[model samples]
Target: MLGAGLLPLGVLLFGALTDRLDANPIEHITHSTGKWAIRLLLLSLAVRPAQRWLGWSWALPLRRTLGLLAFTYACLHFLTWLVLDQFFDWEAILEDVAERRYITMGFAAFLCLVPLAITSTRSWIRRLGRRWISLHRLVYAAAVFAVIHYLWQVKADWLPPAIHAAILAALLAARFRFRTRPVSVAQSPGGS
Candidate 1:
């Protein structure tokens, strides 16, 4: 599963080594990383719905793995922008963040992921307990900002972002739908 989760990064690494990336390597890497970040973020968020609907409790552990992988890709995306695109020009970066709506949304998405990644460890989980869950809910916000950033940044394509938005809407609806539904005694906790 981890290897599967890493498949996109592996492909990116292979592209780098083989010089298969297009004329604009920075743009290619940035888009690839951001795309995978949102993909994995949505995947991680889907874990709970899968568990609730399919009774696949065994899949729960993958949530953290997917979340962390999403964070990794998000960091890579941000670094590609900061280092390759802006050359660490903090002034220019700040100006872009302030002036560009897409950049602002992407920056906001990255910021949301930071603390979630920091506190993802089991030790932090044990220490923080319920609060950890609340903090991690930031994933939803991250997903929202990421999709909007992608959608808003694309100059020519709307299909991809529209699809992402639809998926997010479905996931959120499923989350609420499942939460509001009453669990029956037949499906009560730990009956086995």
Candidate 2:
């Protein structure tokens, strides 16, 4: 699981070292990291559905790892944009987040992820108790913002973001359907 999560970063590094990232290396890096971040985030969201529908119980444990990996890629993506593209210009960064809808969406998504990542530890989980679950629900909002971010950023192409949005819709729909499912009397609490 760790190896799988690190593979994209390794490949990105290899590309940089080999001079294979093309002329706009920063653009390539930013896009690559953002793509991996969203892909991993979606994969993490899929884990619960896979467990419930396909009975893949082994996948249940992977949710946290995948989410953290997604966060890692997201951080890299943000860093590439901040350090390489914007050259640490806070004024411009704030301006972009304020003026650009896509940048706003992506920044919102990153903000949603921050607390979730910070509270992912065992000690934090114990400290937060039930509140932890509620807080982590921000991941859904984060995913939504990320999809919007990707969709709005595309200049001419719509296929990629469209597909991502469709997948996200399906996943959220499945989750709602699962929650609303009627339990048989025998399956209800304290039923004989």
Candidate 3:
């Protein structure tokens, strides 16, 4: 999980130091961060399905790790856009968030992630109890908003975003199917 989360950051740092981020460095950096954020978010969502369907016990801890990584990369992505692209122009940033559909969606998706990330601790889990699970379900909507943000932002090739959307659709479908299945003792949350 650490490798999965940190490899992109490592690659970005290496690329920046080596001058391998292409001509528009800021654009490249922002794009890399955003892509990794989305990819990590998707992978985090997959952990549970993988665990449930294949009985992979290790995947349980990976969910939280990947979720944190997703949030981290998302923060980097937004920061790159704000500091590098917009140069801390509050008015322009507000305008983009208000006027641009893609930006609005992206910002909304990030906002949704904020609370989830904040309440992801073991202490929060103990405090929230069953309500924690309900709150974390916001991930589904966050994923959808993220894909739409990506889709709307693309100008030329739509294949990548389309593929992401398709994958998300398949994952959600599988989740629905899994929910309909009978919960065995082995599959139940508190079951031994």
Candidate 4:
């Protein structure tokens, strides 16, 4: 509910404040939206580790919401670039997608996110069952693409993107290492 409400409100607020937003208003909006999308995507991915290690089952419900929010922000980022920045110029947008490495990487990430978002519903979960897990695994690829997109866009000062990429690598490593590790029984102070 908050995601749905805040999205439109954000658009409206950005639209209203566009004049005073920044020197490159569209670029500012695009970067801001993309950043939020990547952040939410990382947060969504963290939910599983949080649940497993901290045993915070309650956080499970928020995973879907976070994933959806990531998709929402990604859409906003794409639209801001296509409509606002390019003025709906399909030819120019196509050229950019074809020529710009960062744009291509970003587009790939956005495209991968689409199916995951679509299949996040309860109905899809029920319909796909165990297969749903494999389908949603695309998020890993999306994260990689997102990191590449950010890295490719930076002309200099690779520090920020490198940090984000390192965090993503650590998160993914945690998932792989802990995913199948057996939970051993804790021995009581008194031997059984």
Candidate 5:
């Protein structure tokens, strides 16, 4: 609800703040939306590790919401680039997607996220059961592609994307470690 409300608010705020938005308002909107998408994706990935390491189980409930928010922002990012930046020129956009390596990577990432978002509902979760988890693991791949997309687009500065990549790596690593760790005795009832 908050994210849905904030989308338009963000667009309005950006429009109000700058007349031209640094000479390329469309590009600025595209980049900003893409950056926020990556940030939300990273935040979604961090929830599990945070819950496990910090014992903040409440974070679990927000994971799906955050993932959906990431997808929302990703859709906004793609639409901004497609409609606003390319002016709905399908031919040109197709050419760019085919020719631009970064765009292809970002497109692939966006594609991966679609299924995950679709399956995020309780109905899909119940229907898929264990397979749901394996399917949603696509998030890891999506995060990698998103980071690569950011890295490829930014010519001079790599620090921000690199930081997001690092966080993703750490979160994935934590999941692997958590899975393999022996169950702690303290987790058992009546055990100290």
Candidate 6:
């Protein structure tokens, strides 16, 4: 699972080294990282539903790893925007965060992942106890914000973002449709 998680990062790094990215390399990197972040996040969210609907028990254990990888990619996406796109221009960064709707949504999604990544460790899991599950539910909102961010960023081509949004809606709907607790022991907040 770790190898699977790192494959996207590896491909990104290889593209950077080989000059295989698009003419606008910064945009390419940002899009790739952001896309992967959203993909992994959705995959993490699907784990429980997959276990419930598809009866794939193996899917449950990969949730945390997938979520962590999604967070890592989100961080990289933000850094690419900050360092490569804006060249560390704090003013521009702030302006984008404050004024640009897509940027604001993406930044909000990234902020939602920050605490989840920080508390992903076993020790932090034990420390946070039941509060952890409530906090991690933020992923649902983050995923929504991320899809909105993608939808807002596109100019003419809206198909990909729309598909992602549809998938996310289906996944969230499945959660409510199936009243069973999530398969992850760490995330079973209200289960008796």
- TM-scores of all candidate predictions against the true structure: 0.93, 0.97, 0.92, 0.86, 0.87, 0.91
By summed lDDT, which 10 consecutive residues of candidate 1 come out lowest?
183-192
lDDT of each: 0.93, 0.95, 0.92, 0.87, 0.86, 0.93
lDDT of 6 by residue, 140-191 (tens): 9999999999999999989999999999999989977775544666557865
Stretches of model 3 off by over 4 angstroms after superposition: 181-192
What overall lDDT, based on C-alpha atoms, would model 3 receive against the true structure? 0.92
Say which prediction, candidate 5 or candidate 6, comes out ahead on lDDT: 6
lDDT of candidate 2 vs native? 0.95
What residue pairs are clashing in model 4?
A: none
The better candidate by TM-score, 1 or 2, is 2
Clashing pairs in 5: none
Which regions of candidate 5 are displaced past 4 Å? 1-20, 184-192
* Cα error of candidate 6 at position 71, Å: 0.6
Comparing 3 with 6 on TM-score, the higher-scoring candidate is 3
* lDDT of candidate 2 over 49-168, digit per residue (tens): 999989999998899999999999999999999999999999999999999999999999999999999999999999999999999999999999999999999999899999999999
lDDT of 6: 0.93
Candidate 1 CA-lDDT value? 0.93
* Index of the highest-lDDT prediction: 2
| Candidate with the larger TM-score of 2 and 3 | 2
Count of clashing residue pairs in every prediction: 0, 0, 0, 0, 0, 0
Q: Considering only N, C-alpha and C atoms within 3 Å, which residue pairs clash in candidate 6?
A: none
Highest TM-score scorer? 2
RMSD of each: 1.9, 1.0, 2.4, 4.1, 2.8, 4.2
Q: Write the per-residue lDDT of candidate 5 for residues 1-192, one digit (tens) a residue.
A: 456636753774678485746577778778878888898889889988888779999889888888988898899899988888899999999999999999998999999999999999999999999999999999989998999999888898889988887888888888889878877789767779
- Between candidates 1 and 2, the one scoring higher on lDDT is 2
